[model samples]
Target: MLYQNFSKTPVLAAAATSLLLLLLLSSTAHAEAPMAANEATEVVISASRIEMARESSGSAITVLDSDYLEQNQVQVVSDVLRDVPGVAVSRTGGAGAPTQVRIRGAEANQTLVLIDGIEVNDVASGSEFNFAHLMNLEVERIEVLRGAQSALWGSDAMGGVINIVTKRGKGSLNGKITVEGGSYDTHQETLAINAGTDDYHYALSGTLLNTNGISAASEERGNREKDGYKNATINLKSGIDLLDNLSMDLVVRHVKSDVDTDSFLGGVGAVDSDDNTETEQTSGKVSAKLDLLDEQWHHRLSFSANDTDNTFFTAGTESYNSQGYKQKYEYQTDLFLYSSLTNSDDLEHRFTFAAEHEEEEFYNKGFSTIDRDMDVSGYVVEYGANIDDRYYATVAGRRDINSLFQNANTYRLTFAGWVTDSVRLHTSKGKGIKNPTLFELFGSTPDYTGNADLRPEENSTWDVGTEYHFNALDGYVDLTYFHTDVTNLITGSGQTSVNMPSDAKIKGVELSLVLRPSDNTRLNSSYTYTDSNDGNGNELVRRPEHVASINGSYLFSNDQTRLTTGVQYNGKQDDIEYDANWNTSTVTLSDYTLVNVALTHQLNKHIELFGRVDNLLNEEYEEVLTYGTKGINGMVGITITGSL
Candidate 1:
């Protein structure tokens, strides 16, 4: 029942109507493609591993630059992505809790995450990324690509990809420092330094965060104890010009965190006790880039490694503990060839060839019967072209050889072009895959058992969209319709895991808008409508039918002061609830709305002050069924930017 039954709910009806308006508005517009407010063109990679202008990007992509992140006072990586269309985010509890990122209704594990050029997804688990500890102190930009990307990125790209690019040093010496404090006994400190000369450059940063947070469970659940969290992060980047045309660089990141948690069994929230967990992640990448043929040809070779260690302690048991660790390694090479097209006017072609080999090693004292090691190898080739400065096309294919699943092939074809000066159209289709995790395929215990016979989960996705650029209004609007079909989905039935007999279908429409009415005023809005159902036509869990967000900000005092307001609305969704007997049942959570506000002012060229208030209305809402959310909390801080 794809959108046919949305008339039953008033909110759904309104969303459907808005989608139609978006279609009509974009289809009829004529004039010129919208330009960025800064009037500066941006270059992006992640679409095909080759840099291209944003307007020529083949996939639906969103870029969050440093300025935007700063204006929003974003603390974590997930905060920067909450307003993007076609994406969904949920957390189990407070700041240090686990977070799940979903794109276009696909499962969380079906998404791939990258830091610079290194993949951060835990291969031994469900291939999911935990954003709780991923601070944003040193990040320069974040790129989010929505759709099936496995054709170029391999497994776990079935939903999409998130590429995090950190800051790099250039030119002269400079530094920044920030200190913040807020409700719930929260405090934070950040420092960043950069220095460079013609031959060498370096950037270094660190962050310290501590908070005596609210309860992990809802206040009404009779849980009164607080769960505190503390974390420290460090990032270092260095580059050297070995020769005029060749450069070498290294990126190192480390994070350590401790979190106090609440234990809940059978869908009930228990009070916080001695249940605490500590995690440490260390990752590094070393690479060399060579420019040949007057910078027309580019070659990059990189090697990266990521290691994580975690320990969990139970209440009232000093001798009982569980620990796990993972080590991942990757080697990659990319070669790009750029050439001009003779037949097409002012057209350019970029051909890319890439190869990768990765290995993952995991050990857990909590699980005794799981595999300890796995390996995968992949190869890819892609061709992308910009035709006559208005048309863009891309085609790519990949082959992945898995240790347990033998081999899989993936491919993609995408295109984008301007229908008129102001109206643009885009569409793409791709294939993706996700292999079974160690717990799903090898676990054997009284409460749960694995299925060695399970098949790899595979999917095909397609999307079409139109965008209208309103140069006069200084804004743009986009509407996209997407559909995904997945087969061999693995599910749990009681104590055992098995593949579903049929397939699941997820279809949705997304609408996004950005407006800069004045030189110092900006507004952003997005809406998403999703219909996700299982093979039997039952609504899937946590896939909300409607999600919307709107944010507006204005700068005064010659752009030295800024004030922002925001709102988020989340509609009802289905979730699973377990009874005391361990029986599972579906439940629908109520809809909710949250409001937030922020203020910032510059005291001088070297000093600035900022404050933020989240959940301004103190609305009691939950992203996860039973997890608690912060209410009516505020933070104030000052930033120092200058030559050290």
Candidate 2:
């Protein structure tokens, strides 16, 4: 009966299709090159917490520039990540059913999300950030690190890291405004403004979104509801020139969102939900970078705090509230020299040292949930040296102490060599760990209990890779193979336990290529093959066996108009089987492929028109076995800008 209650909606579909057709018909098409110029050979900055050439490291990393974000007309940060290799994004129930992102077989808590060099992962839930309510209008670029980095960032670096850089002031006061509407009564709006002066610079942005829930299941009528969500963000950054060589910068950011949904367990109907949840957050950080020490030495000091308060009530029932908060502090120093040991062969050396501390607390009322409080402190030391521009090596070590764990030690070794001007090879190995969060130790409902005796998960990983860059043609390709083994996995039964036989392993390969033929058209493609399993040979839930994506865009050399299309494939997965109400069952999740298309036209100097189509085939699929995903959808938007 649950699967037999699917509903059909066509008006929204028709509007989305019409908008796409009109935009495409009005634009001129062009041929795409095998790769994009400069894109394929671009170096990433997130891998080592600093800028470095892609081929100069053993790890795998991906870069997403602003052009890709604009062509897709995406309003949320999560939407922009769909094309990353080995990364999967899923949304359940509706726009706010709690989104989840998995990378390379790692669980949600294993991955780390950074916004402008700041960690955004929730310590209470020990979960990767959903980014469901984060607006993309403020993003300048995105860098993804695809391997373990615990030696540098401490726990939660086992899965990898995604760093988002915010837009900065360039030459003038730049800003834009975007508004969009589509099916399921979805709508979005965003605004950004930035400016700079000889002595001061700053940028500010805000965004809002609303949508009606789609069908939760094939035939469920009432399961499909509506969500009214609001997100507000304010960022202020300023820099002051103190002396000829010294400057200071201050950054402050605050974000908050509210989500409303229907409760399926409280009632059975086609258009109502009795359950409600609201999540709100306020976070801010201040950092200062000092270059006055010397031309070769730099110093940075920063402090940040994040406070989250969440509440849940069933069917107009009031009596429960939950809260979570985290505070972090960091200091770093770096020394760069053109010639360290000697001035011969144009050799160079760099050294870095950093210290950090964090405090996290969780509290809940009106339910059987455990309250958690933790304090963590860590330090890192690293050194890198390059000789004759042909050989390089890096060594790093870290030590972390937490209230829950005595001390965790990690280390990394990296080597790179250039056999030829066009080819390079690299290798790296590192140790990492993921610590337990508050929710895992003490969250409760009618069916679950917390485990307080859990230990941190530990892992060691190694990666090898090669890159060939034909800079002459602005083309490049890279391939990497990685393996990770984890132990002391934490799980719940009557209580939490640290078990070695419960460990897991993951092996994977990644390939990325980019080409630019004539400077106006660009093509980028990536593919991943992964095998992940537990000691008992059970497949990890929610992870696809393989993933592939290709994105192509065309624009007139003048950069006035552009069109883009992409395709993604998520392989089939084994379902989760467990005892629910004394019965056990299994469900096989079907694999699915999706296509997306988008077009943008610069209609003069002050306005732009854009449209996009999602799930082109109207395919129905689930991200979490029996969970739900949105069906075919489309949206049309307009952006306006002004300069003074």
> In candidate 2, what are the lDDT values of residues 1-644, reduced to their tens digit?
11111122222233344335434532332222111113444567666655676655666777887877877776676776767876867665556666777777777678888777667776545445766656675777888776678888878787788878787665588888889999778888888888887766777777777776564432334244455555666666556666666667666667766666543321221234465667776666777766522345556667677776667766657546667777776766655555435556755666677777777787766455557687777878888776766787889898888888779899888888888988888888888888877766665543345666777888878888888876775777878888888887664343232444677898898787877765788888888888888777877666777878888889976688888888888778765544433233345578888888898889999999989898889887777543456778999999899875
Instruction: Write one digit per residue (lDDT tens) for candidate 1, span 1-644.
Output: 11123234233333344335434533333223322112354567788886666678768887777867777788888865778888878887788887888888888888888887777776434567788888897788888888899988888798899988888887689999999999999999999999988899999999999999888876666777888899999999999999998999998888899988777666463455667777788888888887654455556766677777666666734322222233333323333233346754655555566666666665544435344556676777787776776888999998888888879999998999998999989888999888876556665443466677888889999999998988877878999999999998777776677888889999999999988887888888999999988898888788888989998888995778999888888789887777766677888888888788889999888999999998899988778877788888999999999985
lDDT for model 1 comes to 0.77
Evaluated at residue 628, the lDDT of candidate 2 is: 54
lDDT of each: 0.77, 0.70
CA shift of 106, model 1, Å: 1.0
Q: Give, for candidate 1, the lowest lDDT window spanning 10 residues.
A: 1-10
Candidate 1 collision pairs: none
For model 2, state the Cα shift of residue 598 in Å: 0.6
As a TM-score, model 1 comes out at 0.90
